[model samples]
Target: MNKALLMCLLILPGHAIALVIDSSKPIEISANMVVIDERKNISTYIGKASITQGSLILNAEIIQLFSNQQSVIKIIAKGTHKQLAHYQQNQPNQSRFIEARALNITYLIEQELVHLKGKAHLVQGFDSFSGGTLDYDIKNDKIITSMSKDGTQRVRFKIKL
Candidate 1:
């Protein structure tokens, strides 16, 4: 399989992390269009899907969620999707720990991994990283980001404490 394809599969719903809350019901979504396939246990929101989970916020032009199984198995996102993963640290101030964006994104619940393709970018406070493609293992807190190796292009980043 292609690297991009592998990354996508790794981040699909059933492949990522165990759900912290199973009773969490679906909330209302306002978008241009929405479709739910009960037979497949899949829900698709298009033309802008905004999902909020506690401090986490996600925005995507299209989002496909698999919810039929005991666990959420796969998530396919496309078109300018952005994610903000926030939390409260030891400090008094709330922290936006991580923000990410991509043309397409996928999360595998069982694998606890996230894959971002096409102009992927990630920001964490003063530190920021960007690449043509990215793969993040959320459970292990590992990230692999890369750009085309050709000499005609350049990839730049900035990090500050």
Candidate 2:
């Protein structure tokens, strides 16, 4: 809730976006209700939760923060089928920003990884990716996607030169 507490929770090993300016900017979170459990080191935000910092923004119906020893270890955001959780961050010195959306999004800060499931979609500049599941390795700049087991959903990509 407080600035110091939010900053401490976000200053992890690898940032979601490698934006220098974004980190310097303050983080802002908005939601209908927030529940913090100090003993469990977990914080939950219910009802149209949104977090913003500089050019970065994340929105979901429910957002949960998991921390260990005052440092954030993981973050999970969930949304309904009609309105998927969304994440966006501006690229350094670029007009276009990277965007992602899914029914559920899991961010592993220390590992520098992001998992997107249920109608996952990611877009950067003019390139785009969509699938049933998407695993993004932030540190390695690699992405792995898969189709649904029932074969109803398939992987799709659109890249522009």
Candidate 3:
């Protein structure tokens, strides 16, 4: 297998794959509104913010992450979401991947799944995938995506990997 794919499989826990982010520096973010509810202990960053964690980069107009008394429970990102690009490197190999755009995304930590609504698309090498609503189970390497109520004009892909 390719090094990136192998790394994804090796670093992943059980069936979960690792979304790696490799950068020389931390991601810089600028936002209009950043709210932290000390009472509830939830923090939200809104209005044109970007986040980079390892090899993954996410940009959205609004990104909200909720945490309970202990840990983060949910993360919701919306408004013109997109992935700039990604790169991976391993022993004697390297590769790059990119995504065009993402609409609305909700991540449920407890459920270990990421839900993407609206126009979502993923691109890798010469292959591409687009769908209206997509649900990915990070823990199981499974994807359950479907079209909206807009008839057959929409595309969907459901895979259990």
List the candidate 1 regions with Cα displacement exceeding 4 Å. 1-28, 80-95, 148-154
Model 3 per-residue lDDT tens digits across residues 1-161 = 55533432222222121132342434433457766665765556777765554554556778765666555567677765254212111211224344435577776767866677777655433445567776756557455667776854287443333
Q: Which ranges of candidate 3 are over 4 A from the true structure? A: 1-29, 81-100, 124-126, 156-161
The runs of at least 3 residues in candidate 2 whose Cα sits more than 4 Å from the true structure, single-residue gaps closed, are: 1-20, 93-95
The ten-residue window of minimal lDDT in model 3 covers 84-93
TM-score of each: 0.68, 0.84, 0.62
Q: If the candidates were sorted by their TM-score against the true structure, best first, what order would they fall in?
A: 2, 1, 3
Give one digit per residue, the lDDT tens place, for model 2 in 1-161: 68635643554323433356676676677888878776787778889998787887889999887877646678899999989999887765445887889999998867868899999999868888989999877667677999977777799999899
Question: What does candidate 3 score on TM?
Answer: 0.62
- Overall local distance difference test of candidate 3: 0.53
Candidate 2 residue 65 C-alpha distance from true site, Å: 0.7
Of the candidates shown, which would achieve the greatest TM-score relative to the real structure?
2
Report backbone clashes per prediction. 18, 0, 5
Question: What's the lDDT for all of these models?
Answer: 0.58, 0.78, 0.53
